[model samples]
Target chain A: MTLELSTLVAILAMAAATILTRVSGLFLIERVKLSGRARQALEAIPPAVLMAVVAPTALMTGMAETMACAVTALAALRLPLLAATAIGVVCVAVLRAIGL
Target chain B: MTEIIDETNTGQKPDAGGFMDGAKAILPLIAAVLPVGLVYGAVAAGKGLSVLEAALMSALVFAGGSQFVAMDIWTHPASWAGLGFAALLVNVRHVLLSASIGPKMTAFSTPKKYASMLFLADEIWAIAEMKAREARLTPAWFAGVVAPFYASWVLSSVVGAIGGALLGDPALVGLDFAFPAVFIVLIMNFWQGRRTGAVLLASAIAAIGVKSFTGGAWYIAAGALAGLAVAAFASQGEKTENGETVE
Candidate 1:
């Protein structure tokens, strides 16, 4: 219920920054005509970004996390998204329980 | 259904499957993000934020990764500049996401396109990309996913802020692994060929390297740049090969 002035400022600042990132791309699209190498680079963004976000967790976190990532990736090959995520959650829980 | 709607409509026909399709597609993500929202709320409460503050942040920022990072470095009095910069760095990827998907939004009016970007979180963007691959990206479809997903995040944050302590640590059940797990699945879906493999490898290496040295969120930016560099270089090589053949 209590809203600190400083906290409010910080939250607004974060929201502004996020808004800039979200809208800036549309601006870029309107200005730049992408093709060839630029198009290739754009195509790579999705996987690259997703990988970068998770790389530290998947490879650097711990044995349990790395193993769970693998399990999730393998399950994703066949299982639905929810099912694969469930398997990964269960796998990590078990691995942590065993002290991995 | 199309005929029924067409008779009542003046010119714009509701994209028949867009909204429902988006809703159905986003259901799994909604389930996955519930625990995450709860965890974020719990963490905010632990960090001394009131439930109202937590809910406000969730609703406004709506980007989970940077929100977590902000909480990590949250100060007593709060440093708006520092946290804002951190959010910018973590979310810079949205620029690339926007560029990639912006063009696919052929069905969206210019204003609608800009308005929709406000809700472009990782999950929403990912689902939108999947939808685009199959059909024209429509406003109704995007709204469908955004509505339910956004609601879950805000409501769960409130719940977590109010009752998070009773729920205890989420790591006990490994709920945190849900996000990376979901990302891994999404990555697998993005696999195109050897090119994708190269991009993923470069990204992983750079990310791990930067994370080890700097020990912060710079890894995501570094890794993304490295991957983009590789794809650009690979495309350049292809262009050269084509030139040689033309000779």
Candidate 2:
């Protein structure tokens, strides 16, 4: 069901949904007490989401992306962030240059 | 009786200097978000969205994860409900962020507090929380972080949208790799020994598994949920942040 709603409507709906989320945690906390485990899980979520976002792309994409991400991950183990990014970018560039 | 805040917690009220102070504080985050904003613009433009539409999404939605996924799945006759739901799920984390900032923001007038939330991003929230721990977290301090980041986000997206036309292929120039690499660094920071590793590994497995099974980016939220479950289980009797083993 594509274009079931107009673009403006869709955008507005998404924004409203996002704002609801922004306010909900605060709103709920006042009435509902979140257990420590719940808070810990929340703390753990952002990284997991990031992992989810990238892991699949690396899997489905071609060598350039995979290598770039691998280099980034490996470099991440030891190097600072910007340096690791450079290494990843360069690795992918080199791989792509060779027609991989 | 008004609850007492310590002296360190009662610094200058948000003043005219608050805006400038915030602008300066966010310089590093501004630099960090710039490329992401550019890539978002390029990606959205590549999807056939008009420049105005892409910029509008960035300005209005202002959530990077949802925006990226939405753009990825965008097609003619778009699935509006799917986009809305996916964005809602991905941003569910913001519920926690907003709540964490809620007590500190109590100092602000209601309108000021709500207005500040409009531009809240992961980085902005982190900065505000950090400020809160250190001392008084003025709404101005929060706005200071938001100002540069918000400007950088919207403007960089505009530049990338316009540049996308001239640049032909963003992937060829290696812009695509930048975000993944950047995220790798961000993810690495969240690393907390095996506990974190286990959660991340499971989440990645769940994500990749779902991607293979369904071929949908919605796996991101699914995987995140999986990790949350794991973290909840892992939390029982875990070591505290201060290196004290909790029973």
Model 2 lDDT per residue over A16-87, tens place: 878888877777776787778887788788788888888876777897888778778889999866678778
Q: Residue by residue across B3-97, what tens digits does model 1's lDDT show?
A: 23322453566665667877888998899788778878888988899999999999999998788878767888989998898788778878888
CAPRI-style quality class for the chain A–B interface of candidate 1: medium
Regions of candidate 1 where Cα sits further than 4 Å from its true position: B1-8, B11-25, B72-77, B133-137, B237-247
Worst 10 residues of 2 chain A by lDDT: A1-10
Q: Model 1: which residue pairs collide?
A: none
Q: Tens digits of per-residue lDDT for model 1 on A8-30?
A: 99999999999999999989888
Best by DockQ: 1
Off by over 4 Å in 2: A1-5, A77-83, B1-14, B241-247
Give the clashing residue pairs of candidate 2, or none.
A3-B77, B22-B144
Question: What DockQ number belongs to candidate 1?
Answer: 0.68
Weakest 10 consecutive residues, lDDT, candidate 1 chain B? B238-247
